[model samples]
Target: MDQAVIPFDWARMLLGEEPPTFLLEILLRTIVIYIYTFGLIRWIGGRSISQLSMVEFLLVIALGSAVGDSLFYPDVPLLHAMLVITVIVLINKGLDYLILWSDKAQTAINGIPNWIVRSGRLNPDQTSDRGIGKAEVLALLRIEGISNLGEVEHAFLEANGDLSVFRAREPIAGMPIVPPHEICPLPHVEPSLREGEPSPKLCCFDCGMLQSRAETACLHCKGEVWTEAKMPDSRLA
Candidate 1:
């Protein structure tokens, strides 16, 4: 017959079915993984943790699983986890070298920086290709205290997922993104202006390209929807 269960078997609960010497093995296992992890991290370049590229991100995920599993699971041997970690780190290092030596390799693995905004207009092709929306770009611009797209000359979505923005020396009329579209929706322009009147500056709702109100559609995006282009508020500028 099976042994009766004991409710308050503290020794069995704490120590488990293994011998007390297994505690020593656990300690050794932890030390080895800790040292190996530390050494591998040190060997890797001192890039900011916030800026982890694709390969670095993969290294973190693999090491985290292997190290955590070996640390507590009695069945998992330290050497096995260590070997996995070593192989992953070696592959990561090799990829790093390849990235350094070959532009094509770097582009393939890390991705190329995409021009999200150029000449105060959103690059719809690049932004859509990168799976970035106008709202996201606007949020990043807001972080940089940009009130409107007119204030930006250029903005790039970096390979490491950072936004790089350059301010325009002479700002032009552009679509206002601040206060968000939800709070203050873009003001639509009337279809027709008075005869012989100068055309009002209008921007494509989709791509933010400035154009004359006389045009039926935006030249950049061929979008029919448009709103009055806003000049940057001097106070915000």
Candidate 2:
């Protein structure tokens, strides 16, 4: 095994230096802190650092504070710091391994995403588990001008440190929403036209077949709903 020998510096202070050993000590401490921080970050995870949960969030803050120690203490030897960092990194890796190997352990540490909204209802159990209440959810919804859960087609607490939602319908407008199920397309039907002038007047969406002389039906097929009006072809309107 290779070993690093860091000797104590005690004479620089006596050579008219402003406690030169203090500077070395600070450097040493910085090295140690850097190692630990790097390892912990790597092991616990740094790729998705911004997505840490509650406890992990706290650790990240603490990690920042630990890194700040370098600003005040510099005498810490770099090798010792590296050693500590390596150990921390190892520990992080060990924890991750445990999480990966055990399903139950993974759930205990980092929970899986849960369905907070289902069947147009906010699940109370799921809300509580995420440490969030209905009020918060509603508040978020309100921010998006959503008044009722019915407006939501799908809502879930994402493990990526966010709450995402999708709504069912087109929202009475050109809305991009999360659809629960694929739309069952209506069978293709030809458009109806007014009977006259060689060909019938093409169905225009702007003014549906509903003219002053309108009956309650598609003029040609007599189908009550002018389905074609709502179809993509309606863009010609």
Candidate 3:
């Protein structure tokens, strides 16, 4: 080993002894592969890593492994790797075609979008099916700048696993349109007997009349029952 070190093979050092191809050949091959992979990815709907779907992720892994091995390994044939990549892209395109033409195929490949919130109410049933909890929903809401379910008109668990939130165009004054499960009961206030007390404490549900008490009937409209006026929270304001 010492004797061999004394006489350095400059040519071998500069250009690999058992080179897969010439230096020029390797350079061209690498360039070709890079360009081809980029075009393929673009054709197959390229997305940022954070936005990648399962199929896109798998495609990235497969392309990276194959291209990297062929670029440096003397034993790996470039043409063979290229062929494999080409076949993979072809299969991906085929799947895309199927997805476009067949509803079942699209649902199977991409999954259906789940409605997490509808009409300002959380969809408990939808979340349960997808293994999502209320905490996760709340976190997602915050990500979309929503402080509470009351502000959301509709929210969806997209097919790619992202939360898409839609806000109400015209929010109700005090009543949040949220689901029945999330409605909070208010404290009942007794009707004031004194004439000097606060006037018309609640509004009749059936009629527009305001009354100081939760009367059996509205005085003006002769309607039954009333609901307390709800004010918007500080966060909403």
Candidate 4:
């Protein structure tokens, strides 16, 4: 017999070798569900493998139940039903690969994670931009068993939809003493702003660091503000 098509009797027997179309359609449906489920979840923002907020967690359960309901309906024809599931799965996989292979597709499907914390401090604009709160921040920290603010060195709300925590052995230095280079200013602001705004309180110039404010002449290179601007950018180790 040609393998591309099944004989009517063969189809009937398979639909229910014992009862309904033999389990072949169910098996095909299962395979489609598995491949698409795994791949689609990957593209939908990494919720499958990571800790999720209450809303995110609920979405997974609802999606799984909806798919399961469609798979189990008895009135649907066996082969046709399986093909429908297969089509849906293929669409999912295709989208997943598109997101993986193209940067633009990724940006379109899921926006980036904003920085909730920078320089060991809360970033209000960034947090508000993403609609995240300090309560969520506390929860993320508690998962890492860090209850105190001082213990956390740096934390990031990562792009793959995860809260990445960085705890250092030494607590970050206090602003009163460390040079300005040691500080990381918040996003959306430039360095070298005067004090009307809440810029970093400590001035590197005051600490004998090469800056224009504390001294008219930079102590290290005797360079003025323009010369200081040309200095190499600082690197964090």
Predicted structure with the largest lDDT when compared to the true one: 1
For every candidate in turn, the CA RMSD to the true structure comes to 8.6, 16.3, 13.0, 13.9
Pairs that collide, model 4: 14-21, 14-22, 15-20, 15-21, 15-22, 16-20, 16-21, 16-22
lDDT of 4 by residue, 176-230 (tens): 1112233532222133455664332221221113232434443433433321211
lDDT of 1 by residue, 70-89 (tens): 67765555556666677667
lDDT of each: 0.75, 0.46, 0.57, 0.46
Off by over 4 Å in 1: 1-50, 193-195, 234-237
For 1-237, candidate 3 gives per-residue lDDT tens digits of: 433432344443345354545645645564566547645543333213337664566577767887887677655555556655776676667777888899998776666777877655556667766667766676667767765444567888876668888888754223221322245433343455575665444544333234545366766556554545332242232
Candidate 2 deviant stretches above 4 angstroms: 1-50, 53-59, 74-80, 142-147, 169-237
* Model 4 per-residue lDDT at 198: 39
When summed lDDT is taken over every stretch of 10 residues in candidate 2, the lowest stretch is: 172-181
User: What does candidate 3 score in Cα RMSD to the true structure?
Assistant: 13.0
